[model samples]
Target: MELDDDSANGLLRSFGRQVQALRIRRGMSKAELGAELSYSQSQIGSIEIGRRVMQSDAIDRADAVLDAGGVLIAMKEQVERAGFPKFFRDARRYEAKAVELHVYATQAVPGLLQTADYMQGVIRMERPQPPAHVMEQHITSRLERQKLFDRDPAVSMSFVVEENLLRRTFGNLDMMREQWERLLELGRRHHIELQVMPTACAEHAGMDGPFTLMETDQGQRIAYVEVQRVSRLHTDRKHVRELELKYGIIRAQALSPSASL
Candidate 1:
């Protein structure tokens, strides 16, 4: 689904702000809204900030409870576009509303948790020929995408990383150590789960590469597969279903979530 680039981002930001405004206009505190909808205060905050995806059920309840305008309901189609690509403008839209995210990365640490220094080193190595400013822009964009994890209450995130990522030198040894430590901190968080797939793990589906699967509130799911320079979104029923099964298996085969670090 092609979208006007600016329109997509604008709509997303507006949707997030509107949700928060609607709740406030209705005199609904975050806790009250959560109580009414069975969502935690943090979950509600994430949804309001557009750092998370809003579920259809949540929308319906919001409209009824807060007497929201048909604004959000009308935006559903665009919201679906959030699952359209990797590194896509819509990916953030999809992720903002996701209640859960399961990811598998074989080549590198997940982008959301990567440090600026680590990202800069990785970008320099991968695009050594690019001009300095070009590399800086790329690095800046990467850092901006990380705001997804900064929302209050945080999103429920699970990562399955290949052991190779730990040994890969993104920059200098010191930077690699810092990156690993960052990963360890994220791993210990209450809402984050990190799993490592041992190098010796028998051949598996993820051997092909990294992918992320996100589940929205209304139970719809989207799969994002990334390659070196391109990422594809799998929205077809059969493709999505197949990935779901594969992801379940990978999660089971990977090291226990606690030991991934």
Candidate 2:
């Protein structure tokens, strides 16, 4: 409930209110609008009260149905950003625009490479777990970030993931199998490289923990790290260089993409 008062929540609430107003002006009941939009009445209520975020296609449908004339369409970006945790919105922005990205993962799989079930399993691990709606928002935002994979001029990406992390059953064996399949599927992509770091290695450059290095098309370089739920984005050249060097060593230590796959 307290989360509904945050800046992100405020944006969602504002969007919801506008949708509600438009619906009312068109002489539509929640039930009727729900039918038209292919959502349940309760789902519409959840959206109208800002308890849920609607998908892009649904929003587009609602805009046309309500005669919003692009008003609702325009808020798409802001509403989408509201779906992520406050600490991560900035990091996702930089990651999305990266011309070249390298990741050294020690904990879970990087978000870009995760399956929906894996994301759900990871979300369940949070303390004082987020409400159901929050889970939807987080997952939605995560799936959105993966659009980076299809970007034209396709962003070059690589990840050095710890070997043992892949073996853990975050939820169940079935879910882990799906995730493994996903990894194998993505590894076949020409622009993405997946490496697995052996846990038996005596020395590891990334002992400091997981971090990512990103280089945007503009030539801007940055480093990102997160522990617990807190994250920092480093823009200072020296700090970025240290992480960059660590990633290079990590890639070397890990099995090559072909062997790892």
Candidate 3:
């Protein structure tokens, strides 16, 4: 099915088109596919039209029912990744392979460190409201990304968040407290270091805004910067080096990891 509005990201629309075509080729109607998957026909229709976020497991279910020989299942990662903003996709891919991750967060806790309730609060504050399903999918995908912390041959990770993030109440006082406790727990891991930039700092290097620097196992470095809705991943050697220097300074200016908690 050719989508009239191409506004949705290409990966999402492509996944939807592939699902619709495979179902049709197998002599299955939307209703039949829904019945097989235990979803309502309208839910199936919404998925086919790219109006609904496809849950991770739904891809496997579709693959089995349509007997697509793993074709649909192979697209699961890309489909789930489509839940995030377009600019963030490449960074997510790089993060998965990074040997070391350095982050400087100015406004809020980094996504990987955020608790579910905290994430929901952030999502609810978006200017234009996202549909409930979309919001849930975003939350699910974000949580899935946190699995990187537990992967074998764990990645070395460091974060320097502004002190205000801990004080900022996202959902409620309880939620903020929980988020702080989670950060404390994460900091206890040998592979992770958590620091806070004090509000009383006379000067800081991260005034340029938040950015992440990632070093791959092969020693290649990349830098990512996001502001407002625009984000970019920097691969240029000189640019990445500059970001690395700035991050080093920011880390030095932040509170010691042992003192942060």
Candidate 4:
């Protein structure tokens, strides 16, 4: 499962090169390193070949075992930051800095609001299924993004989801029930406003698609729109203003926060 072009300067490949070089300098076989880190030899080999994402604790343990002087630990941030796809990187950065978020979801639950089981089910349904390890990396990365909800100065957020999404079963009955319960829990948060847009609603403004509008700490506003595999972050004032207006309308048409639950 090793990547063919490890010489390319991507973060994962670069990290793999560092790990391989350090392991060699220490005269440790992959099996020995895996034993020290309590991982399988194949796991260590995959990480060393840029085919697997290294968990933070694993990187820390590797740093110690290889006597890397914090080099691997320092690279952990970059590795985590690069966990998301290239198209999502800009939006991820903006979202991390946002003080407020307005989101509209049509087809499925938004990533921020999805439970682990729900996320796995959604990812598993992709047209061309990904390898188990790659899927695990994506799930881990998404769950990490949800840490934003626990920030000291919590971000104020509002969401409008299509009613069909609530009825759709992802995972299984038990998982779907858990997801519904989680939605109710999130709706009760002081900084969060959750609304459901019933199919019966005649005046829906989100027919165009799913989008997010974010207000940064400095009060700068940006809009993110995604379809298929492509995404765009709109920074132009006019474009953002239009999305803001559309979101306002969508929220107005959605069921009240309490009623939606």
TM per candidate comes to: 0.64, 0.89, 0.80, 0.82
Clashing pairs in 3: none
On a 0 to 100 scale, what is the lDDT of residue 29 in model 2? 95
lDDT of each: 0.73, 0.87, 0.84, 0.86
Error of 4 at 184 (Å): 1.6
Clashes of each: 6, 0, 0, 0
Off by over 4 Å in 3: 1-67
lDDT of 1 by residue, 1-261 (tens): 566635545555677788789888888899998888778898678666554555555667776787876877777656544312225655656776778788888888887779989877766677435555445435545665565566565778889888988899965899998899999988898888898888998867676778889887677788888676676777777988888888888988989977776
Superposed on all Cα atoms, the candidates' RMSDs to the truth, in angstroms, are: 9.6, 2.9, 4.2, 4.2
State the lDDT of candidate 2 residue by residue for 112-212, as single tens digits: 89999999999999999999999988887888888888889989999999988898789999999999999999999999999999999887888889988
Q: Which stretches of candidate 2 lie over 4 Å from their true place?
A: 1-5, 27-41, 56-65
Give the candidates in order of TM-score, highest first. Answer: 2, 4, 3, 1
Task: Compute the lDDT of residue 160 as modeled in candidate 2.
Answer: 94
